[model samples]
Target: VVDFAKFKNLIGAGFINAQRGLDDSTHAEKDILGKILGKLFRSGNTDAAPSEMKESTLALKQVVDGMQKTVDTDFRTGVAKLLPGLKIFGYPGISDSELSTETTLNVGTILESHTRIRYDQGDGLFLPETYNGLGSRNLIYMLFQLYEFFRDWQSRLIENGIYLIFIEEPEAHLHPQMQQVFIKRINEIVDQFSTTLNVGKPWPVQFVITTHSTHIANETEFESIRYFLTEKNQQRTTRIKDLRKEFRASDLEIDKQFLHKYLTLTKCDLFFCDKAVLIEGPTERILMPNLIEKVDKNLTEELKLKGQFISVVEVGGAYMHHFYKFLDFLELRTLVITDLDSTALESGKYPACEVSKGTHT
Candidate 1:
């Protein structure tokens, strides 16, 4: 009679082969053999067809001949090599079912090897979307790598006694708070490294950055500020005229409180004055009034010139526009002649209406 038990053992072995990327579909064929034996081989058949008889004769001969061999030296040793974790039963010892259990352990080994290789290759790296793979990574690693490269470059610059550093778009791709941290991170890293190295001098890296970020702009002082204004015709432009030491102690004190903190009030004054004509500003005030008197020859004379009382305000161009409408409200004859600023005219909202077809100045 055919052995159904031996057929089931082969099927379990085939499964392990497939999982290990080994050749063969022996398991499926063995299962088919088991089903066939269960249905057709209930009774022992002494007489059979020529082909069937021959196959059974050969198989039976092999079994009887194999039984004559020493179980310990031949079959047991060979099986132990093939299936390491094979467990044995009682007197019958090591049935085909027990061999199948041993093969199950081999299948686990195959699966583990494949899984480890996949993990090492970073299976999720090329995936289009995110994955929860244990070996996956994020952009922080790339950022840290880039930071190391730049820190080395900055150190070289410091070694040569380089003082100036300019960076544009330092806030690129970052939120406001992140931009602040970005600056802080650079500052902290450079200072810390430089301190440890004792490079050239203290705080070796000084920076000048151009940024449209309001947070960055707010962090600057007046000396670091530079303002430029262009007017309607685009021909007029001006920059702050320095008069740092020209003013008296009182004027400088006034400017200290006014220039930076009260820029709004100063800008408005420019709009109200008929000719802003920035004189020697804070320090310039000491000699500006006298200079105007000298030029106009009005040492002792007073004339009712309409809008001629030019308020020579001593302030920067930024806050100049602050007082434009305030003076206009007071019905003062004002002209902001300090800079060729078109901020008022650019909006096309000045008080002057477009002249009619027949009108001419």
Candidate 2:
């Protein structure tokens, strides 16, 4: 069991690394799937035939199923709590218009196993717990359950009283087609279930997303798109919206530029500026040193004790979290002052600035 766990752990870790480095042609560990197959064969625990290999894979799956059964009590409970209204298709008296109070769920690999789906007792979707048993179902099957659960529940939520749907990282572990389908389903639910807005009536049910996927970004309405840039050491963020430019690619060509833009956005968030001042807007930024001069003729003088020259930078929005570390890396002390009215308040208060990088001049 310990050896199996080690093997599984190594295989899982390799998959994560492989996904991240898929774009690099020079990366040596490119064929992670091939490596996994080789490792399984080299273990020599199973017999040396193709049929034996298949049986070994099934045995591994069974072990997984046994482990999941032990943990699924908590997993099942958590899933239930998240779902309040669920009108399953098979249940009697479950009409389309009325909200459902109960659901039946099964979690496992229904696709791979010819096993019939018999439920214990519940009131939601089926999330199979085992399939053809090597220990349980593969991770991919588990993900599919989540996808089905969310998709159906979201459809109902929109039908009821959805004003806006905010999705973060919806593209995680999903293909581009699945991402597009998810969005299309959401739109369909909105049209099917929402109340039509009268001339001055507000539109009910809008969608807002913060995503890292280029495919998802491209599929969305161009007008709704916003891009943010961050400088790591300087601790700066710039938000741009309603861009007069559009970058698109045809099916024949890969959108490397769009992908590069996404990478650059992430890179800026790690920027390193030695000593920086964070300003709310363009004009006030220009006058920070002078304003500080007027407010405390000794502010810059005091800052000099930190041993660094300061540059006042204007970030489009207040995203100090992304830029602060970069500024500190460049040995800079940051003094950030922004007008609250111009920007939406972020979820949390500004973190205390770290000034360790710069020495007192």
Q: Identify the candidate with maximal TM-score.
A: 1
Write down the lDDT of every candidate, Cα atoms only. 0.40, 0.43
| Model 2 TM-score (2 dp) | 0.26
Candidate 2 local lDDT, 109-166, one digit each (tens): 3222324333244786554323223112222332333333222223231222333344
Q: Per-residue lDDT of 1-361 in model 1, one digit per residue for the tens?
A: 6687544322211010112221132322112212223222221122322244346545644664465455535656666777644334344445434442121212222222322211133855543212222112112222332333333333231232334455554545456566555654666666665565334345344565556554444334444543333333666754432222322346355544454354433333332234545432465667665666666664334552322656565555555554443333333454343432222233435333344421222
Alpha-carbon RMSD to native, per candidate: 31.1, 25.0
Q: For model 1, which pairs clash?
A: 247-283, 267-319, 267-320, 268-322, 268-323, 273-335, 274-335, 276-337, 277-338, 280-284
lDDT of 2 at 237: 58
Q: What lDDT score goes with residue 169 in model 2?
A: 59
Question: In model 2, what is the error at residue 155, expressed in angstroms?
Answer: 16
